[model samples]
Target chain A: MSVVELARPIEKARATPKGPRRRVTAWHRWLSPLALLVVWQIASATGLLPERLLAAPADIASTAVELTQAGTLPTAIGVSLQRVLIGFLVGGTAGIVLALVAGLSRAGENAVDPIMQALRALPFFGLIPLFILWFGIGEEPKILLVALAVSFPLYLNTFSGIRGVDGKLAEVATTLKLSRGQLIRHIVLPGALPQTLVGLRQALGVAWLALIVAEQVNATTGLGYMINDAREFLRTDVIVVGLLVYSALGLATDAIVRLLERRALAWRRGFLA
Target chain B: MATRLSGVARAFGDRVVLDSLDLVLGDGEFTALLGRSGSGKSTLLRALAGLDHEVTGTIDVTGSVAVAFQEPRLVPWKRLLANITLGLDAPVTKAKEALAEVGLAERADAWPLTLSGGEAQRASLARALVREPELLLLDEPFSALDALTRITVHQLVLELWARHRPAVLLVTHDVDEALLLADRVLVLDEGRIAHDVSITAGRPRHREDPELVALRTTLLAALGVSPEGRS
Candidate 1:
């Protein structure tokens, strides 16, 4: 039989529609959320929902624009972005290095994996009080906190990814007379990459969470600091705007990782959805 | 001689898989090894391929060896052409030529996951052939293919073998496939070659030939199957 004949069934299965063919436009997803925002705005304008409790969407938007023009919001965002970038770099590098050491050799795994597993068991956020005492309320502790939170997911995933490489492929490499370095470069690392990217996505998510919590506790200037300063003045509009910015940053970073996944894992398209 | 194995023995725990086996293949010879389930056919092939280091004996191959396994185990991350040239230190043009030979020239840049089973098997064959191996070990490579695809691949393998003149050792369970392809058919029993027969007939030998019909019955009886379609 021709290759096309053999592949036709799989193609048909994938092409078959599972449900109703009604086309749902992209904006349909936002319909309910937009309606809720409208209801909240009407309530705020009618004085039913007090400004002390929460800011209306319109008020939050105006506050965001005002802060942007005044350069306060931009500065806060810059500081927060810098902290996450530095922390992620440090933690990401450490995680990958450790995973390589542990995953590649038996001696490395024996020396490193036990300690890592032990350390990973502890709730990382619980280290905040101890961190503040040790590093003071400086950028050291804040950046370190984000680094700590970011490292575990990457280390765990990368280690498992490396370990999970197919033994069959390794055998094939051996039969092909691949040198030691070539075997690792061509087979093991590439095999491990899909899982490593998954770890990256997870690490990024936790990095942002760690930064927000760290800034909340003892930040002199950042989005978290701005929110804290607004709390004293009861500026709910500014607080709402800061919260929105934090979520937007998280979503934007996630989208970037998704794009990277698409590019790196293009080979996986026909194998799975 | 292309390859020789003397007193090669392998055992997993108390179960002996290969019991002091001795075999030889002439240069550019096509040999088919047949065995029932658990008859150590794969063990012997693995030993010759130098993949089973625990096989206690001497396995001397004159030159390079390559294997195309049943699964066509291509690295999923690599394109077809890259898979063919993996670790071979060959130019892209050589790999492209091999792809063209396998009728996969247009799929050189395709991901392995996207290829159908037959196409992937052909790519696997290209990968092995690109090495220009002196001994090509095929471990049931065509067993997973449909009958028509198997026939096509069988033809392709014969064509490649003719052109490259590589000594081929095909491990298979199909009696017809062995009779159709090999210069010699060997049946393994009790971890040793129990039946070794030579097919001296010319190329494109007829399955319905009186001599082949007689040989088939003899081989079937040797495999402990009755000629009357009984067990």
Candidate 2:
């Protein structure tokens, strides 16, 4: 509306102009996977692997279809996933509570920390025998094993999270006359959340791995069992099928955690990512 | 309520920081505690805040305390509103009101990372005020700021203290800052009170009054620095 104002140097006001758009989009994200599939197909067609010994993609695909038709794949995944959920919820909650107790009280830390540290250092997979012996080979042992595998990471992370909180923040908490519970709930928990979440995410992956390892010998209705049953007749196709299912499931779980992390660690986006 | 620190003694390893320190803070009085670097002024403030339990002394105060540290120490994960409300049992609405009081209403939902140092310190001040503390403690609350920001915060703290009427104990190494904000200045040297000078200047004190200039010159000399043109 005013020629003189329009003629003023807008460059000084804005300083930096927006740059050109990038050619990159997410359309090419699948290229590497597609290329890998092509390579697998080529290898199968070229007879690089023995047809019976190593199942071709087509054989594995047909096996997958058969398993799908028989409702075995869904059932197996259901059992595995159910076990994971129960174990993670129970284990994660207990770990956080214990961590808080130990972190807050010097006596509790003295009594519990060394034991927990030793337990955490022990090879979790090696404890399967003791768990079986103690709890029998029922679903109890399997579930408990998954829970045991998860507890250490969650507890350690939560403990460190509590310890790592800034002392100045605690001083402020005291200055305001915050009650013990109030201080832990508001200051300690949020301050240690990122580390705790990291622990929970790590524990989740460990739970899945532990569940699969648990399912190996006697499990009749999980992906591990499916693969074990396949190995009786040497059906590597079904083994590959099991491996694929497990990988996809793990990827989905990790993506869910990462989505939660984006919300949890939204503040750390620039620094962390 | 009055606060008294009687025969307060603190030592770190072999070095003595505060030796039988005796002081009384009158009701609603503003005192600036001055000392050299590593002079344990912060330790004294922390002891007053009930943070240093190992220190041997009877620190008697009739009401609750609130401390504003040199660093804002806001929770990085929490929003400005949440950080200010962290130690309270009150509802979120009350926290929002406190943030609004500090002119940070719009930044209520913004994370602490987005705040400037001055803004963060203001939020820290808001945090202290939210508790309505009877005694306020500050340790070099504006040391990290430029002159303008420092003066702004000094005025803000003075205004808040004037309105809230809490006994304030502020620790700083800056002589000019001591003159600008304090009712009385307690100078510490070699772990002892070297001087306790009263500022006779009236309320809303001018920064460069003759008395302030005289006191500033004296404090600088006590701090072992030549006036104005020291190399």
lDDT of each residue in A94-168, candidate 1, tens digit only: 998999999999999998899999999989889999999999999999999889888899999999999999999
TM-score of chain B of each: 0.97, 0.94
Quote model 2's TM-score. Answer: 0.88
lDDT of 2: 0.83
| Ten contiguous residues with the weakest lDDT in model 2 chain A | A16-25
TM-score of chain B of 1: 0.97
Judged by whole-model lDDT over C-alpha atoms, candidate 1 comes out at 0.91
Q: Candidate 1: which stretches are off by over 4 Å?
A: A1-25
The whole-model lDDT of each prediction reads 0.91, 0.83
After TM-score superposition, the amount by which residue A236's alpha carbon in candidate 2 deviates from its true location, in angstroms, is 2.4
Q: Tell me which residue pairs clash in candidate 1.
A: none
